[model samples]
Target: MNQLLNLRAQVVKTLLSVQQGQSLSTILHQQLDQIAPKDRALFHELVLGTLRQWFSLKALTLPLLSKPLDNPTVESCLYVGLYQILCTRIAPHAAISETVTATKQLGFPALSGVVNAILRRATRETEQFQQTLNQTHGLPSWLYKRLKKDWPEQLESLCQALKQSAAITLRVNQRKIGRDAYLTKLEDTDVQAQACPYADAGVFLKQSVQIPELVGFSQGWFSVQDQHAQLSASLLPNLDGKTVIDACAAPGGKTAHLLEKFKPSLLIALDQDEKRLNRVTENLQRLDLNSDHVQIMAADATTWQATRMVDCIVLDAPCSAIGVLRRHPDIRLLRQASDIAETVALQKQILQNMWQQLKVGGTLLYITCSILKAENEQQMIEFFAEHPEAQEEKIIADWGIPQTHGRQLLPLDQQGDGFYYCRIKKIA
Candidate 1:
């Protein structure tokens, strides 16, 4: 019983940390080690599931409270209890008991009764609670309004997609193994997966599994990448023996992909966050892609100058990350309306900087895990006006919606997260 309470207490603490402005990923990375391996799954499910449906859970629980709870931790406890009872297959009695006990374990023994009463009331009024949740979109008002304005026709479906969990997608390393061969290996192991329809090397796992435990993980047979993200390598013109730049390329999924597909004469991966650069190096090395041909550097994309003009540049610029909310639900809580303008300014500066480093007729693929117009289509429109030498190289692809500037893949249930891609050429 104590162990269960400790585990539930940890979930509440993690959620409170997110509510306190810490990222869910960062917190999980820092704290997962302390949790028992068997309990980590439940911990992650509780934390992520609660955040995914945070707004709706809030709506379901708030009306039960006569007055708002003064303590944020206690409030987070209520959310955890409400989520499990309403969302999971866990029995209502067990969910409520564990949660109330966990609240006491969190040093709120006096409020344990309050937590129990609220959850029991919620279970008793399941239909009404579900109605409240159904009516809610699980997004903040500002974001909800923005999405509604941006995608009026698809708003309902888009919100529903965002609330669900994302599937684990992988990009098979063609250099080491063929996609069909890898699928055969997965089948041999009873791992259920299917080839992505559009991405030649993409595969969607039927369920999430520890990445390192996958069949070819240690041998570098594959790299976990989104089907949408895999398109970046294909979007660019062939770069065999050509120079390339992957700007803002920490945790180098795209960088490695570029190297794997094109075998570029030189590929420089640049990112400003020095700490994150380590991840890029680790991933490259694990994939056995670390070579003299690839250079990983910690540098600001907006200010760094390339030694020479390159044949291709992939600016995976930073943005609100609004499109990947399913993978990182905490984004909805961390991002603000004001942050969008700041991000746009940064993206514009980096685009202009990268443009200066591209050779004439060189291809620069602009990508972002964002669906906002201001950061995507509108941004491209402004860029076209600023650089007369720049020309739009329309991406003729079957996936994603063709926008005024590029293509957009809206988040869909059991499909890719929202991503936007635009290809431009230095026509001067």
Candidate 2:
């Protein structure tokens, strides 16, 4: 089969069962072995880029055609071609010719006339075309409207930020090596590194580098974490040798950071998924920090509780992950307006359950990879109403991109995921 046909087949096969909450990159990686390495790279780039800028591309292509292309096969074929011409650095002629040829090869030879006419018009009407594309394609109207309502003053900036790619940040595991020593080791290998200002152990790469290949990584010198997430560990005050709980800890990024920062007397890490929790074990084992100092349990935080009130608890509540859209483009297509309500309810339940496990004067740092008010600010507001004893700590005022209730790191800026955090202290 031709490269384009193969690409289309993969795209269709993946999207066929595109359920909510599945990772786009993980799905693509599963099918990667089928295509040539070069074509696989280009195929993923086009699929993700087209999804990222779907609003923009459809806006550009719609005017040239009389109406929407209803057939999924024809529409995807068109997107395969238009996405290349508009988004990629591929020469317009090459993009158009190759895409048209692929349509014929993929059992749509009759649509060649339609594909040629649309692409030719797209090239000919460049200026008027570009403006329409911008007006329509830059942001999905539903998301744009919601963001505008929520962040009136900063909506434009937020939209721009969400559209760009996220930066790769690493949290240095001080158990094996300090930040300065890690940087020197990286520089020796010609990897560019810069300190992430907010967290002591955090570092930003000038270029993306594979983590396992870096020196000390196998020994647990560092792990990939966003600067915003690294701050989640820092928000817990008076963490020294205390009993701390990382409820809903998965892949153990935050749990490992907590282990490093607090060196807590007891660190109980709990996650619902056994497979995902194994990831946390892997991270801990690699760093040599997975000791009797920590306890890993495959349990749901919504109901799980310690035998006694712990010194501190980090409740990284689940929510509509509208914030990390840049890193996971699949969310843009899979998320629905209704998903927010269910997420809010789940977050609320977990918060109430986890808060009960916190001892007096202990802290519960509520966090989410979400920008929605229903999940962040509004949820916090409701929690305060129910529990008058809980008070907002307001730990880091300027840790991330500014938001009304808590700091939100935009994915577009700082090259980080969109994250929301609010810390609460129990006084009663």
Using lDDT, give the best candidate's number: 1
Question: Cα deviation of 238 in candidate 2 (Å)?
Answer: 3.1
**Cα-based lDDT for every prediction:** 0.89, 0.77
Candidate 2: stretches off by over 4 Å: 1-4, 8-26, 124-131, 401-405
- Candidate 2 local lDDT, 328-390, one digit each (tens): 767877888877889899998889898888899998888999887788888888889899899
Give per-residue lDDT, candidate 1, residue 263: 75
- Model 2's alpha-carbon lDDT is 0.77
Once fitted onto the true fold, the runs of candidate 1 whose alpha carbons sit more than 4 angstroms away are 1-5
Instruction: Give the alpha carbon lDDT tens digit for every residue of 177-207 in model 1.
Output: 9999999999998899999988899999997
